[model samples]
Target: MTPETVMEIGVQTMEVTALLAAPLLLSALVVGLLIGMLQAATQINEMTLTFVPKLMVVALVLLFAGPALLETLLGFTIRLLEGIPELIG
Candidate 1:
């Protein structure tokens, strides 16, 4: 309820969001970079060339990181719910 508490909650929310999104975003970035390099070297300027590989990499990353991501989100949710009583008190 307090400004400090509200700010803390907002910061934690942002942190959790970033943590959850990092893997997918990083995979996309890496795939894009590699595709860019390949396109530059081969002079193939196909705009859609990067999409499929990025999608596949993202899928693979999600497949591998899904459990840890779920665990992290679940932990954060449980912690947030548990803190409600403390915040109210």
Candidate 2:
């Protein structure tokens, strides 16, 4: 493939990756921020207090968003595979 085509593919790959990861990452970020605030307010300062909640929220997010994420990744994979001939020739 040409350099432009390669770059385009790279950009699309990154976009798909970000889209798939955003939900879990965002949930973790929000949970962590809230936990941090609570820790500051109450002076709990326990590591597991932060870790467990964020872990649970992330798991919940994944459970809810998993199907959509899978669909997006599958779509991207199919599109990339279909474009292989054009890219090669």
Candidate 3:
């Protein structure tokens, strides 16, 4: 592939990765932020307080987004595999 093509592929790969990860990541971020706020408000400085909610939120996101995420990854993989010969040729 040309440099431009390689760059394009790289950018697309990153975009797909970010798209797949965004829901779970954003959920975790929001949960963490909420936990932080709660901690600040109550002056409850327990480090572990953040872990359970974040884990639960992440798990919930994965439960909800799992199918879509898997499909996205599968599609990306299939496209990449289909392009392999073109990439080599």
lDDT of each: 0.96, 0.93, 0.94
lDDT of 3 by residue, 5-71 (tens): 8998999999999999899999999999999999999999999999999999999989989999999
> How does candidate 2 fare on TM-score?
0.97
Stretches of candidate 2 off by over 4 Å are none
Q: What's the ranking of the predictions by TM-score, best on top?
A: 2, 1, 3
- Candidate 3: TM-score? 0.94
TM-scores, all candidates, are: 0.96, 0.97, 0.94
Best by lDDT: 1
lDDT of 1 by residue, 1-89 (tens): 79999999999999999999999999999999999999999999999899999999999999999999999999999999999999998
What does each candidate score in C-alpha RMSD?
Answer: 0.7, 0.6, 0.9
Q: Candidate 2 lDDT, tens digit per residue, 1-89?
A: 89999999999999999998889999999999999999999999899898989999999999889999999999999999999999999
Stretches of model 1 off by over 4 angstroms after superposition = none
Which scores higher on lDDT, 1 or 3? 1
The TM-score leader among the candidates is 2
Residues forming the 10-long window of minimal summed lDDT in candidate 2: 45-54
